[model samples]
Target: MGFAERFPRWTSAVLAIIQLALTAVIIGLEIKSIFIDLAHGTIWVGFWASLIFIKTLVMMLFITCCCRGRCCATYVLAWNIFSGILACVTIYFDRTFINDPCKCYLGDKLCCAVRSVDSFRTNYTSILDQCGQAIANNDKTALQWCSTGSPPYDKVQYLKAQLGCAVGMLISCALYVVIYIFACLGICFGHD
Candidate 1:
């Protein structure tokens, strides 16, 4: 059986849709930062936007891989593994440390200011108090983790390089071409 026979064409279409949808959900996670954290400064806004765009492009890469099939399937798997690790790091930091703020995946991977409070969206009094503590106290421990180099936070960047980021990016670029070719020529190339 060929690639399509090994996996039904419908499977690819379904997976592409599912992956794209999940990517949207991941992007939504950043919305909290956009409204609440990014507004705190233009610097933060620029940072987060860049990370968001990067993630969006990665999703687009995965979708293209599904559509073309076989080629770069290994690379797609590796890309996803790296992505999952980052997601885990995000969850760990969000739950445990105040300094290890949730990193934006797509656009900039920039740090969103972390106040020692809970709810991201709301007029909670705790948020202001946390901000006051962050500002007035000049907590060095908090500051240390606040940098992207801190625990859990540094893991995402570390994995990307080890995975041969340049080769992965090249695969992404190839997938983009495959997508464009099909868009213009209609599966003629993808089939054989």
Candidate 2:
């Protein structure tokens, strides 16, 4: 017997669980990004994240249902196709969104503005000092998580999270591809 014949139930459960975990991580990262964006008065970033988060939540439900019953083969195939398309679109848009420079400031004083050619999106923020003054712009000032000895709130962390989400999405796409292939095979062979 082939892999599918030996352990069909086990395979379905494992794939569902893995996809669920990846989606959960994607959700957590997006939530963090939302909080960060809200703190900075940026709406679009959080809005996109919210959309993706909701979609992932729906995917989680489908996967859960798939794990519980035999009525899920067709649904799973459709969900996988939708997820793959969404993931591709998300990755493309994320690349476009993060390609701008972020202007970091504390009030009217420009604390630090990223160089105009950074490879990430704009995450304009204001980090105030204890005196309610903005930190001076310097080579060490970073917006996300930075190794440049910059203050907290470096935009690098946000960019990294976006990349992580894209990776998870790609993995999910691959999983769905495998699932749909088997689903088609089952249908053609009259196994279902």
Candidate 3:
């Protein structure tokens, strides 16, 4: 095949691979966040959505590699559209959820942060004194786990990584859309 004929297939394959890798990174981050109790509802949503998107990308890659002619153009276009929407939603969810103000715990026993001090007090009375003392003294190490203004250091890093990967996924999706548009046009003009 000529360069023009093979360009779309190569681009589609490369974009799908990149997106799959980014989605896997997001899933890994979500799983780690769950262990630290940093995974919010939106994180869970993003996790599930990433899983679905991974499957979709795999299928699209297979179709793009194996299918010839214009028969699969409509299917690929539809998948690309869905992937673009999913990536956008993931970006929004990650941005809003991570930036929201919430307490993050960094103690030996408590690694999760809650929104309400009263709720935290009621839930973990055993560590209340320690947390209170740390808060009162403003001990940097101890306060790291008891502060209420922002997320813990680890959680912040995790959120940043997830957000970065989400943005990468969005970029890949956009590239896929562009490549598919050219592919569709090629087919319409009997170039494929």
Candidate 4:
């Protein structure tokens, strides 16, 4: 069957086009984050490497959006929004995690800390449990128990900064998913 026959009408195809455009935008933003070739001086965020984990997933969802299904496109859109928010949150957390003076640098800007793969690995490993405990309660107290330097602002503020991007991604993804399904059921399936 032709593409239109599978879904009827050209609306699915049209939606697919819009989704594709959005996917392109997301990918472009991701790339821009990584490389700024201009001599204008790239302001590198100290802990950017940690953001790779979230961005990789986003890239996958970007690829998925190139599909032919209207439903699939919608799924991808939803996925993209969710993943984007998630990515942002994860990246934010990563940045904060990296910037933590006690945990990360261990020295002045000019000063070097234990500078080795093994040392880095150990640092991250130590904090894994802390992150988990924080997640268990979704509250800052649990996070503080894990440890952040200074006082009042340390735990909750830091956690909020980290989780905020993640929460944003979650909200966007959820809305996109719901919209796609609703559109498919109502418009594509003829219920609407």
Colliding residue pairs in candidate 2: 98-120, 98-121, 143-153, 143-154, 143-155, 144-154, 144-155, 144-156, 145-157
Mind giving the per-residue lDDT tens digits that candidate 4 earns over 61-119?
44344555564464455545645554565556444543542333222211122222343
TM-score of 1: 0.38
TM-score per candidate? 0.38, 0.51, 0.66, 0.33
Question: Please, what's the RMSD in Å of model 4?
Answer: 12.8
Give each model's clash number.
12, 9, 1, 7
Worst 10 residues of 4 by lDDT: 37-46
**TM-score for model 3?**
0.66
The digit string of per-residue lDDT tens for model 3 on 66-164 reads 874454655665776787677777777667657752433334334333323344546655456666776677666764443443453455566667878
Q: Write candidate 1's Cα lDDT for 91-166 as tens digits.
A: 4433332333343332221132343223455544554565456556765444333343333333333223222332
TM-score of structure candidate 4 = 0.33
Worst 10 residues of 2 by lDDT: 111-120
Whole-model alpha-carbon lDDT for candidate 1 = 0.40
lDDT of 2: 0.47
Which residue segments of model 4 deviate by more than 4 Å? 1-158
- Judged by lDDT relative to the true structure, which candidate is superior, 2 or 3? 3
Clashing pairs in 4: 81-173, 82-173, 85-169, 86-169, 89-165, 89-166, 186-192
Residue 108 in candidate 1 has what lDDT?
Answer: 24
Best by TM-score: 3
lDDT for each candidate structure: 0.40, 0.47, 0.62, 0.40
In model 2, the runs with Cα more than 4 Å from the true position are: 1-7, 39-71, 101-153, 186-192
